[model samples]
Every structure is written in C-alpha cells, then in structure tokens.
Target: MAATAAVAVACGAPAEEPAPEAPHGYVAGAEETAEVQSRLVVADAAGAVRVLDLATEEVVEAGRVDGVGSVTGDGRHAYLASDDGSVRIVDSGSWTVDHGDHTHYYRAAVREVGSVPGADPVAVHADQAVTALALADGTVALLDRARLDEGAVVELATIPRTPHRGPAVPYEGHVLASVAEPGQQFGSGVAVHDRAGAPVATIDEPCPALEGAAVTRRGVVFGCADGALLVSGSDGAFAGEKIPYPQAVTADERVREFRHRPGSALLTARAGEAGIWALDVTARTWTRHDTGPVAAVNSAGAGTALLTLTADGVLHALDPASGAELAATPLLTAPVAPGVRIEVDTSRAYVNDPAAGVIHEIDYADALRVARTFDLGGTPSRMVETGR
Candidate 1:
C-alpha cells in the first residue's frame, strides 16, 4: 500500500512580493554581472524551451521548438535538441529567436527518424557545434551544429540498443552513453563514440541494464540493475564494483533513481526504502542516507544531493558525506513516481511532474525551497539545465 503524509504548508500562500522581472528568466543568487548571471534553460515534453533567470524566479522567455530532446549551454547560449531529430539554439542573453546566427543559434533536424520512446538529449558541445545521445529509438545521433538549416540533419553516427534513460556525458571531446536493455534482464553496456561519430569501443563485462552514467574530468562512472557499479579511466581502462543490495530491500525495492557526481561517486534511491545510498567508487563502499522512499535524487555538485519525496512533494537537501539534512522545501502536491525526472545545478533544481503539467523549481540556497512553477501544457517526462 502507498504511504500517506500530512501537508504542512498552505498550497497558495502568496509568494513573498515578487522580485523585479529579470531580463532573461529568473535570477536567484547574487547580483548578475557579465561573468556571473543566474540563468537556466529547460525543455518540456511538449517541445518548448523555457529560459529562467535564477535570480528573480521568473520565466524570461519561452518559445516553441521541434522536439527539444535535451538541453545544454555554455555560459552564454542554450542548446536544445528534439527526439524527432532536430536541434534549436537560443541566446541566453535576450531569450529571443536567433536561429540565423549560426555562431549563436544552430538548428538541425533529422528526417524519417523513428520514435526514441524513452530517451532524451543528454550532452552538447558549443565549441564544436555537436549534440550527443538519449534517443528511445535505440540509437544515438550526432548532428552538425553549424549548417543546421540545410534541411537534412547530418548524421555523424548512431549508437544502437542503448537503453540508458539518462543524460549522455561528453569528456575529452568524445561522448559516452549507457546502454541497458529492458526487463532489467541482461545485455547492458557502455558505448564510447568519438568526435567523428564512430563507435571506438563498448564495455559490457561489469554490468547490464546500466541505468545511469556520468563522465568526469578523469573518467566515466555507471550504475547497473543488480546493484553493480562500473568505472572506466580516461585511458579506456575498466573497473567493476558491486554495491550491497540491502537484504531488507525487496525486489520491489529497485534503485528508483540515481545521479552521478561527475568526478566523485553515485547517489541512488531505492524503492520501498526510506533512504538514499551514496556509493563511493574508489572505496567500493555504500553509505545509506535515511530520507523516506525518495521519489527522485539529483546531485547538484560534488558533495551536495537533492532528495524528492513524492508523498508530500517535499524536497530535501543532503550533505552526502555526513548524511545530514541541509535544508527542506515542499514542491508539488501530486504523487510523483518513476517517470518524474529532475535536473539540478548548484543554485537551483528543476522537476518535470507529468501529472501537474508543470516544471517545478526549487532554490537550493534558500532552505531548499520551492520558488516557482511553470505549466508545460503536457506531461513533462524529463528536465536538464543548460548554459550554467
């Protein structure tokens, strides 16, 4: 049976008098300068890209784009991709249409591409104008960022049957994707693609049904179905380790969701359990954090983690090292489950609550509070932050 909890805060308390509307979106932290401006761009399931100023907690500008499969940004521009095989570029400064400026806005589309049912756009390279994996059609395609208007999205290459439902990570000019097959049964691996879109190598020995993967400045880390973790050095050397699956945790107790800490370790939440596990790759150890049946988990940075409890729509901030709660704030009211996805940066977090048809925002620095929410018009399946 599902658990129940009491709601503590009123649902509609008028927000502390709204801050001045930001120029781009919502600005959260300190004053915005040429170098340090609070900016975030998110893509919803309905194929729209919304830019927010983290400082002001407001939507700066929103526009329709074809299948915004994923999003990423440098410090100045946000890159968006579509599962239908297209890419849209938006200027972070003005939050307006700049598709004509290839240097700033690069657009591309793939024709006759079948559906990528459970995939998302994971990585982007602004300098090279290349966008990486996350497609449900069991393939990963890399397209040209410059001549996107050529009508035909040039397919640099494709990776097949990679069931990874997480973001693709780009490291040292190459893109890495996790491949896990359905039923959590077998045949999972990691596919490494070069800049030219060629599969250079595939690592399948350690685990299959690999659900999450992240690349750091030094190597790549991935999580498997049966509580296994794998790491590959920057030089392509592979290492495998297993995380103890709590005996008290049943088969129904699966790793509900997880996030990789770029260069450190992995944070995972198990269903039916009221805690999050921090797996240290180097030490080959697991430290469990009691947080109550987490609906979601996201790593904002090295030592900071976010835990979402679906029952009351509350999000908790944790210090992975000490298993201590740093802050807590309530978000959505509806029950969020497996399909609800979240993405975060150091200052803010974004959640795609399909049932609510809106993307909820949480301010990490401010008591892990829910600052604002936006309607997506349809069930949003995934979310990612781009351009800082």
Candidate 2:
C-alpha cells in the first residue's frame, strides 16, 4: 500500500516534478488498500480492548476504556459505551468507503480517538460528515466525522432528548430521528432534522415502540411495534412506508435489533427466544423461522444462509427461504454469555466464546467449517467487526 514513482534524468538535468494527484477517496495519514482490511474489536467487561487483524492474525491493543457495557461499530470506528454515561471511540484503523459503483479501503494506526458523555449509548450511526450517537437516555449527540478521523471527538451539535428509544441516524446532510407523539410512552414515528438539531419534517408513518434502526441499500429501517418502517428519500424530502408483518405477532416476538452485512438489503434478528426474523428490505417482506433458543443471529446478506447461535452454544446455518438447517457446528460451550454476538462479513462469520476465551471464524458457505479459532487469552464479553 505504498506510493512509488520513477523519475528520469537526462544529461544531469534536474527533472521537473509534476503536480501530485491525490488518490481517489484519500484520507490523511491512512494508506489505501486493495482489499477489505477486516479487523475485530474485542472488549471485555473491565474495558480491555484489542483489535485483531483478520488478515495478519496480529492483535494490537487499542488502549482501554472503563466500565464497558457494550461495543458497536460503523464499519470503521468502534464505540465502547460504558455504564457510567461515558463513551469512548476506537478507530480500528481499517474501513471501506462505498461510492455506489466503486469502493475504497484504508488502514492506519489503531488508537482511541476520544470520549463523549452519554449514558449507555444504544446506537451509533455515521455518514461522510457526521456521527450521531443516540443514548439510552434518549439524547442524540452529533460529532464531526472529519475530526473523528483525526482522532478527536468534536461535538458539533446535539439533538435534545426525546421519550423514544430509537436511533437518530445521520442521513444525507440531515438526521433521521425518532419522535414521540403527545401522551405517548414510546417512539411514534421518525422526524428529519438539520445538522444543527432543528426539526425539519416528520415522517407520517406511526411507528410506535420503535426499538431498532439500520441503514441499508434500500433505505433506513426502524423496527416498529406492528411492523418495520422503511424511510427513503433525500434533500429534506423523505417518505415512509410500513412493512407490516404478514401475520399477527406478540410483543415478545418483535425484532429489537437488526444485523446484516454493511449496506446489504437483507437483515436478520432474533425473534424473542425461539425464532429468527428475516427482513428482506428489497422485497419489503418479513420471514419468521422457529429456531430454538437463539443466543445471537446475523447473516452475510443476500445469497447467504441465516447464521444463528443457539442457547446450546452451537452455530447453525439455516436457509433463509425455507428455514431449513443447512449446517451446524459446536462453536461455543453450552450456556454462552448474554453479550455474545455473531458478526458476518462477506466471506466469514465470527462468534466470540467468552467462556473459552476465543473467537471462532466459521465458513458458513462451506457447511459450518471452523476455519480458524483465535485464542484471545481472556474473555471478550462484547465485540464488533470493522473495515467491511
């Protein structure tokens, strides 16, 4: 990933240097790569964080945090949210920028960028210019994305706290936020706001009890009480459409969090305890499968099986169309920790076994093959993959 050039000299004459052209999607202090530089950011409950390079198998200490309750990422930076209302940002030093027809990958030094005060951040979303962090307290904090790339946490603006639990996503030069109706106890719908935290427009869809949000190729999806709300548009003019469940669902069976390959249209989430919910954003449909007692669930998007970790600590790949068990492997010990997660990239699926202090890499396409297992030497309570 080094830049090189050859200069020619004739008769001892000094060669005139041509103007340098910046590489496409070039960022200062980062080296652009040819392939995705995938890295896993693993964190323990005590705040020890490590970045495991998927390609080199090298583990780099990304400093640490204090009282880490959960960890999340936005394809680049890992956000470690602590229980004491403080959040720390760790740049995994790897990421991909998708420009529709083309993409770019980058790598740099892994380091802890900075921290912001927000009690138990539930969601962290980013775009080209801003990062919006939605806390459990309903406050949304917006940080400058460019400064974050420079290892700094600069809060440009903040959307005041609301009564909802949904994420305020950073969309095209605006923020897609959750709003609660008067006299309502939970999120009633989504609203659009400018970067300065001022309201611009409210989507008409009444998405009561919104719990989860994800940005996909189709658009941004928010899990609603009755169904999922799909919001799509740009330039401050957006519209919402309701993708209601085909059949009636109880409160316990509703999807709270969604997982999928970054920018993929298909999403997967655990439905209550004994089922899996697959949402096809392109088809605008939801499919339910009776998977017994799931611990975690995710997929590599279209054409991949639904990868689920059951209560028995075994990983199973199920057909997304018919819910048939396609493959299975005992990846973890029985009675896995509650914070265990299944992270699926394009070619591999990863699961952390806290009890055994290892991360399992499964080849889902090859009948649940345990391709490699990296022993972390310590427990990784929570983890997220970057540089997808």
TM per candidate comes to 0.61, 0.93
Candidate No. with top TM-score: 2
lDDT values, one for every candidate: 0.54, 0.87
Per-residue lDDT, model 1, residue 211, is 56
Write model 2 residue lDDT over 266-296, tens digit each, in one string: 9888789659999999999999998766989
| Global fold similarity of model 1 (TM-score) | 0.61
Clashing pairs in 2: none
lDDT of 1 by residue, 294-327 (tens): 7777676555664545556777777777867787
Q: State the displacement of the C-alpha of residue 328, model 1, in Å, after optimal TM-score superposition.
A: 3.6
